[model samples]
Every structure is written in structure tokens, then in C-alpha cells.
Target: MNLFINKCSKLHETQFNLETIHSLYLTREKIYGLNKYIENNIG
Candidate 1:
């Protein structure tokens, strides 16, 4: 039982880390797009 619980906890931690990374990646892409749009419009 303890071993199962430990495995589940590890999985949850991994999922949380993945979600954080995914969100950061999305934010970076959004920022890059916005910068490109501004540059095109301004320049």
C-alpha cells in the first residue's frame, strides 16, 4: 500500500511539472507572436 501511494505521488508530481512547463511554453509562444505583430505594424 505504501509503495502504491508513493508511485501515485510521484506521478502527480510529474504531471504538475509537465503542466507548468507547458504553460510556460505557451506563454513564450504568445509573447513571441505579439512581438512579431508589433514589429510588423510599427516597422
Candidate 2:
């Protein structure tokens, strides 16, 4: 987790801004959470 954040920090500085990366991360986390919820409740 820390290592991934560190790598993303580098990309945030060079390729994309922090805001963009953070928004994307949030969207991905939300989808992942939803998948887990469905799996636990239905699957």
C-alpha cells in the first residue's frame, strides 16, 4: 500500500496532478467496494 502510494506520488508529480490521480483512485475504490458488497450479499 505504501509502496503503491509512493509510486503514484511520483506519477502525480510528473505525469498527472494529485487531484486527477486522487479522483481516479476514489472512483476505482468505489467500484471495488461495490463489487465486494455485491459478492458478500448476493454471491
Candidate 3:
């Protein structure tokens, strides 16, 4: 029982980390695209 709980906790932590990284990557991509669009239109 204790071992199972420990394993579940570890898995949850890993999942949270992965989700956070994915969200950051997506945000960066969006920002990059928006910057490019602005530069193209302005210049």
C-alpha cells in the first residue's frame, strides 16, 4: 500500500512537469509567430 502510493505520487509529479513544459513550449511558439507577423507588417 505504501509503495503504491509512492509510485503514484511520483507519476503525478512527472506528469505535471511534462504538462508544464509542453505549455511553455506552446506559448513560446505563439509568441514567436506573433512577433514575426508584426515585423512583417511593420517593415
Model 2 lDDT, full chain set:
0.91
Q: Which prediction has more favorable lDDT, 2 or 3?
A: 3
User: How would you encode candidate 3's per-residue C-alpha lDDT over 7-42 as one tens digit per residue?
Assistant: 999999999999999999999999999999999999
lDDT of candidates 1 onward, in order: 0.99, 0.91, 0.98
Q: Cα deviation in Å at residue 20, candidate 3?
A: 0.2
Per-candidate clashes come to 0, 0, 0
Collision count of model 1: 0
After superposition, which runs of candidate 3 have C-alpha atoms over 4 Å from their true positions?
Answer: none
Per-residue lDDT for 40 in model 3?
A: 98
Order of all candidates by lDDT, from best down to worst? 1, 3, 2
Window of ten residues with lowest summed lDDT in model 1? 34-43
TM-scores, all models, native as reference:
0.94, 0.59, 0.92
Q: Candidate 1, residue 16: CA error in Å?
A: 0.5
Instruction: Tell me the deviation in Å of residue 26 in model 2.
Output: 0.4
Scored by TM-score, the top model is: 1
Better of 1 and 2 by lDDT: 1
Model 3, residue 3: displacement in angstroms? 1.0
